[model samples]
Target chain A: MKNTDKSAATARPAPGSCSPGPFSNAKGPDHRGQAFTRPGSGQCMKRNSILDAAARTFCRDGFTGTSIDLIAAEAGVSRQTIYNHYRDKEMLFGAVVDEIIGRMNAVLYGILATFPEKPDNLEADLVLFATRLGKNCMCNQDGEFLRKLIQAEGERYPELFAIWRENGPARVWSAIAARLARLAHCGALDIDDPDLAARQFMALINTDLQFCGMLGEKPTEKQIEDGARNGVRTFLRAFASRGNPSTKADPAVKPNMALF
Target chain B: MKNTDKSAATARPAPGSCSPGPFSNAKGPDHRGQAFTRPGSGQCMKRNSILDAAARTFCRDGFTGTSIDLIAAEAGVSRQTIYNHYRDKEMLFGAVVDEIIGRMNAVLYGILATFPEKPDNLEADLVLFATRLGKNCMCNQDGEFLRKLIQAEGERYPELFAIWRENGPARVWSAIAARLARLAHCGALDIDDPDLAARQFMALINTDLQFCGMLGEKPTEKQIEDGARNGVRTFLRAFASRGNPSTKADPAVKPNMALF
Candidate 1:
């Protein structure tokens, strides 16, 4: 599976920045078994640097516009080394996409772990959870790049898209929904279809940020916060249990916008 | 302006299918004045035929991956004819982008006019409106292509993205918000920020449909309807006036999913 490599990160790889666990020629998840593992930490770091630079160049210039030379210059490495690591730009892009998808997957679960099973402050907790998902997962530089590349190259490369199909947003939505189901069991929210509720929750959060994402601009921390805060509020208005659905609650009163 | 060319289509251009209106070599809105217009309806159709084929090919292949020879074969025109209209692949790609963006714009306004100004059946009216918006504007072939191109080319083509900045979803959100405001004015709904409500409305409806979009799959009509119906329901749950916020209504009880 494409996600098989995420386990190699010995460090609790930070949510948004999942380091390339082990470099591989695994173009698609279907052939992941054939991927040869890299040796040595020095080589691992070097591979990560190349992947990072490739991600940046690809996001900026597009798959066609990007070059091994461009990535090599950005990574401060020789083009031959890049070729030695990844056979071509397509292989490199597949690897880059795999890395980001893994990072975003980590980001999703990391935030999900903090979901409020029991909550005294439902709005605050939900907003915080949504904000972390937005900032660390959706609005981050890698998130921006992943989205850009996905929109740009959806038709041409299915193998490159293996990460999403195998370990993608569908899983993220269901994961979040499972948590919402747990919350619903606790009588914290009124939800009939946890799956639909989960999708809507994400949709609400993404509403405001979609424009910046479309234009390939990174939203300010403020914009991400506002989107999450407002989106979560809308989510609550629809799903919160009776007596808790305070539609008129002041948005400014919630001062806690911290990591969950 | 990129939107300025959309006006040339005097045939009451249908939403989500704006024709080239008039072909011009306008690479970006900045140099629109330099664009030489194609002469005569015959040539206009030929140019549009080439654009249509190019759009398909570009979506199928990335900008660099696509060749003039491939587009000529698809359009059934000589390669020289393709060059006769657009100077290069970049110019051709820009024209294709312009056509789709224009179509999406038409789609947006066409659906916006259907918004429930004053509704006797608010739920039915809003759901129908949202469904049409989803089906006609968002999930159609052109809409899918527009999103893919936007996400794919956000960084490399700022001038090519002039349609969005000059006339884009920002307006769509505000325009939808204005309709919601009118509904609120009539006490058919309860909305505080029309802009936020409009955005959330869009976000909610898109929740279910985002998956197909990500994978570049064209959602079935049923999928589009389900998304819009469920999304509008969630929207109503949050914003429907206190007397009208019926979250438990049967999903199948409503039979009408028609145009506004």
Candidate 2:
């Protein structure tokens, strides 16, 4: 069975699990898996450690719902350490958004990397791509974290919406658009405007799958996989250029725009 | 010149203005050149008047920004009248959303009616149709109101999104999809999934024009009209199976999909 354990620090095995080498001392018991920890002076490392803990806590509880004392206690540090890093609650909340968006991008990019640069079969390529996207969107706890972050920040800090637009969806859109453009250029697909095509494909997936998942109705893993395959099939059929011996071909179809 | 006047009610008939007819009597005296007078006396008439005013106010100010008192004053009715009609703020908001959506649909349908049902020149038909749509999105205040409504209510009330999905964009999509399907059936266009093509066309317009307008950084009206025309042009060239003899001669390549 697949492990769904969420403790980010220890989600993977010890360094020895793969093949322990010269860096084994770094993976010692005091490692604690804290991202903020540094090798030199312990003071700065301790400050970041508190910030990391605060982020996890705020992800679970909202800005108003969480207290500095709780964050301090969870981080195994004093409340003064958190105050040293962040001036107040608002500042801390901003930090949390930054951290969440960064983590989400990392996870998304990791999944997207699974697809080949150019695949032999269009259908197989699309199915593989969509399946990965669907799985990450639904099963990943970080997806919930991003959703809750948007919901909470949208209420209090409206500017976070603009930040999210720039970093989150906009970034993802550009990445997808580039991939589509590459495919269109290689004659894998007959697309006049790659960016527009990419947006439509995304809308199809989000409308059919992600939106439903956001409604608190979780589909099984098999269901997600199947749904992705179907979506890709529909998309490819709509976009593929059918070779037909027909009448006058007014061939003025332009290539993908360079604006993206 | 386009009329830029803003009058609630007025006399001295404005040139280049369509007669609102009965609704004109309900407006203020400045534009129509008349004194303020109540048209009907019954409770139902009075209730409808209040609703009209509330709808106008909700269009101007958002749901949270508006209040019972402003609505009452605008309708020339007491606050008790509003309470009598709507149970609470949420009910009033829902009614306003419905009213605005109705008006939007009316405008879009009116524009569609101006075009021939089946134009001999499909390119000209699409250009004209898209020009009209671009005008509504870029040149009118309705687009701004729509963006606000979507941004404000999209989170708390998914029903609002559903309404737009089902009635506004969805209807337009189905209209285009049906046309594509008919063309495919007649072997005029090489399409497998007309619905997906329709969605893709809509997505092109939305991302290129609607998104810019919503962001309040829109290009000039002429730019929008031209952009939309180009979008339709590219879409047709890419999807229409009209004169590609090479595509039909290939036995190895499957024609996209055979759903249509």
Candidate 3:
């Protein structure tokens, strides 16, 4: 919002996207039930392509602002082709959100399984877990897209998005809490309330990256790593077992942390 | 995005706004230089009515959606009357943002000043400080509006939002960092890298309230207080000096924290 609009419109660098290296969601792909379709099926591919385009467009523009014509152009299909798969614009949008939500939840649970139930190294393992979350679930295409759509359109379509937040993130937080409870059960950490600790852990991880995301900039892998490391370190300081020498705090020592 | 308009439309709840209580600015009002205007100036009041209308409309319907006609209607003024004060829509938007940004920054610093320089009771003092931040800065009208505008339109007008971010939040974070540094220096907390600690502190304060805000729900005073208490308790657990008995962690004690 400015007067005169003097900005010499320079090209904005497309935000970075990092494919997770060490983390893999190997729990069978296509959580949205497209898995049954044979890869060679033309119909399945066409459906997937339309959904992808819809997702991209909806994310860039709010639901009201997006049109079926825009989605068809984006998918490189005729508007008639789009109509063939989905009944109408509303249906198309639902399919996009549903597909991404399914994929997002699947990826989350997949990564949750990677949580170190028995960590040989507490600090490193926690950092690694946080990194996996950032790279795979939070910073990934589905995560970013859903977040944008919700923030932009939640007020307009509250109930529609309500399904999303409840089914996905609401349960997701509880799931994360359960995992922390497991850690506390084994005396790896000293968390009092697993739910509260879980929430803090999540918030801490975002502390380093929240600003960049709010500005629509994708974080680099280095940033994801640095953020993970810093967040995990603080988390350990807060909840690590006092008896555990590995994570024992030495307030005087400012150790240079590197994520391998 | 969803399919089939089968769901009956429901009117959206207009989001709540809280006038921050127990934390008055008190340091001469109107950070946007409206303080200099003599009270009851028709021109100044008219200008502000237009700005308030513009801010409300722009936030509700993003920059592209908002028009001079809409703002004029919202302000109860003739379109020409709005133009008389500001050059155009762009100019009006700028004035609205600038006024809010200035007010936001001032509120932030004013709250920051209340950070306990010497706390006889560390936990209580920190909770009080965090509550002040939440009520006065984050969840208030100016704070919520600017955040919505930035998120909705930052990409379209990257340069415009960039100034708000850099001037308001960037400096605000470092300013928070300085406060934490002072706290650490006084031996109340054990922190390395005040900047990192500062960011964590901000993130922690946001933890309990983030989800509600994302869903476009305004947090109640109770929620803000609960959030501050939970966040401060964790912050102390991570950084409070071991000698500080009030905030010292007890691995077995999951005390029900209460905020005064």
In terms of TM-score, the best-performing candidate is 1
lDDT pick, better of 1 and 2: 1
User: On residues B196-220, what C-alpha lDDT tens digit does candidate 1 reach at each position?
Assistant: 7887898888876786666556678
Would you give me the overall lDDT of model 2? 0.53
Which DockQ values do the candidates obtain, in the order shown?
A: 0.46, 0.06, 0.34
Estimated TM-score for each candidate = 0.80, 0.54, 0.77
Give stretches of model 3 more than 4 Å off: A1-44, A67-69, A249-260, B1-43, B83-87, B246-260
Q: What lDDT is reached at residue A38 by model 1?
A: 35
Which digits, one per residue and each the tens of the lDDT, describe model 3 over residues B1-260? Answer: 33122211211111111221111232232324233234554554555556676776777767766788877765656777676666556766766676777667777778777887774788888889999989987888787787777766677677666767777766767877887788888887888888788778889888877866654678888888888888888888888888787685534223322210
- What tens-digit string does per-residue lDDT give for candidate 2 at B34-134? 22235545654555555566655654455555688887777677776566656666776775565556557778777755543453566567667777876
lDDT of 1 by residue, A4-91 (tens): 3443332222323434443223232231222223345475666766776777778777888788887776665677767666655776
Q: What TM-score does structure 1 among the candidates reach?
A: 0.80
Off by over 4 Å in 2: A1-96, A134-159, A180-260, B1-87, B111-119, B134-170, B209-227, B230-234, B244-260
Which regions of candidate 1 are displaced past 4 Å? A1-44, A245-248, A252-260, B1-42, B245-248, B252-260
Backbone clash pairs in model 3 (N, Cα, C under 3 Å; residues 3+ apart or in different chains), count: 7
Scored against the true structure, residue B60 in model 2 reaches a CA lDDT of: 47
* Best candidate, DockQ: 1
lDDT ranking from best to worst?
1, 3, 2
